[model samples]
Target: MTEIIDYGRFADRLAAPRPRWDLLREFQDEWGYTVPAGVDPWPKWSESEHHAYVRALHEEWTGEEEDPFQGVDRTLPVPKALDEWWDLPFNSFTYSPRLYWTNPEYPLTLRPDPSGYGVSEGLPEPNPFVEPGGDLRLCCFMAEYEYCNEWAYLASEAGHDDPRVLASVGEDGWVLQARSISEFFVLLAAVRLPSHFGWSVQLGDDDFPDGPPVRERIEAAYRPMGFQNWRELGADTALFGGPDVIVRHDTGMADFAVEISGRSRDALAATARTLGWTWDEDLVEPPRKDEESQ
Candidate 1:
């Protein structure tokens, strides 16, 4: 087992002097979780192969016999912090790698789109739908929660190292999600890291009516992961992490419940036994009685 490390509080972790990407890399390394290939575009294919694939895809769609990549640049045209985060394995869950670069390469992800640069973005610039009249124009990282009708992005001018993360809710206007985009990425890791494992169990009071106190039971067996209360998403989460398991207590925007995920079904059952939470194992994944009835 990975030796335990106290990450302090979630908000303070974001505020610490460490660079945002560095903080994220450090935490992920310590979390001891295997990162599945759900996010990120590299590693799944060789660099040369990936570029060739993109070139072929562009040609397939645009049908320009003349190489559109001729004298074209493919390095992602983004800021430094953004570039660093892009280099991290399975970065922010929502960060879809743009087919665009600055002189910045990994931490050299996607080598220079072969030296000879052009005066174009290589691809068409996406129309920014945010801050219509202000300086907060959209750039590379635009986070839209399609299900909730809300979205956020790094709201800043071009070439900014890092910018504020702002999100919109039902026309109520943008709310401050984080002081900097990097912190926002950390917040994403808190949830996405566990979710990447592909199992989540939401438990309400009814699921464990006669069990010990919820927080007390959780604190005794697992390390409280101190995830930020995502008010913009209309939810606050109390997260706990332990050997091969992650449990989250969510309140607001819906019901007060806990979400649990484990590396395997056995791990889930073990966590359940420790916390006094139960579920119908015969069901597909482990569902609460409330959900089974629904």
Candidate 2:
């Protein structure tokens, strides 16, 4: 079992260092979280508050009545020719891999949970895709990679029991956690490629012979596909740029999540075929519990 710590207290500890403390305070102020040198006695907003804020943003976008129970559409608009895409293994519950290009008006909103939290639930099963004896597990991000890690740490400290939030050091010197997935998706959606240009796939620690092959195969696929460079796509923000799609392949687990850029649905489908992958059309659609009840 992973060690659990109180996130509020942890944040306070982080604030003890003068520089780190100032950084934490800035982060909290900028992001709207409360922070101090020590644990504050005040009660933080309940899960409902978090959920409600997300829901309100969604309602504003969709121009529909706010419903706390529904998910938010976090998809971003992208160019048509680039055909940027990502794929998720159907089995992984951590995230849905089959995002595609849609109408510009379709604003992506994240769905809120019962407590109004924006985080997705953990997968029902542990990942089996990481190679049995492999020491490293890699998760790449197109944007806000650091924040994703911070969020994972926060969730773990908050007494959440999800394995994805657990910090596990892999034998290959990689630290495995969950928040990377969400940040990667957000990065892909926000990247803006130059006209007729696409982004490249890059993974850290390419020194291993086993790693390059995967990168090569993905790169080879992109060359003929008419995708452009990532910089041309207007990834000026810290939370943007890098690979248009991020995939986490684990040898230990049989499951993975695919996050794609919202470029063009047809292009995304074509790219998936090149990689010998397929996506479920039904899963591509957003979740709707109300429709199922009827």
lDDT by residue for model 2 (1-294), tens? 022222223223332534322332332222222222232221111222333466588778989876532333223222221112122221111121122121111112221123333232321223442344432222111112211111122222222221232222222212233332332222233231111122122222232234235434454543221112112111211121122232222223212222232223444455445454445564342222222211
**Local distance difference test, each candidate:** 0.49, 0.27
**Leading candidate by lDDT:** 1
State how far residue 29 of model 2 sits from its true place (Å). Answer: 22
In candidate 2, where is summed lDDT lowest over 10 consecutive residues? 97-106
lDDT of 1 by residue, 214-294 (tens): 777887877665444544356656667776677777665635567777655666777788888765655225322221111
Candidate 2 yields a Cα-based lDDT of 0.27
Best by TM-score: 1
- How many steric overlaps does candidate 2 have? 40
TM-scores for all predictions: 0.52, 0.23
Which whole-number lDDT from 0 to 100 does residue 53 have in model 2?
62
Error of 1 at 65 (Å): 19
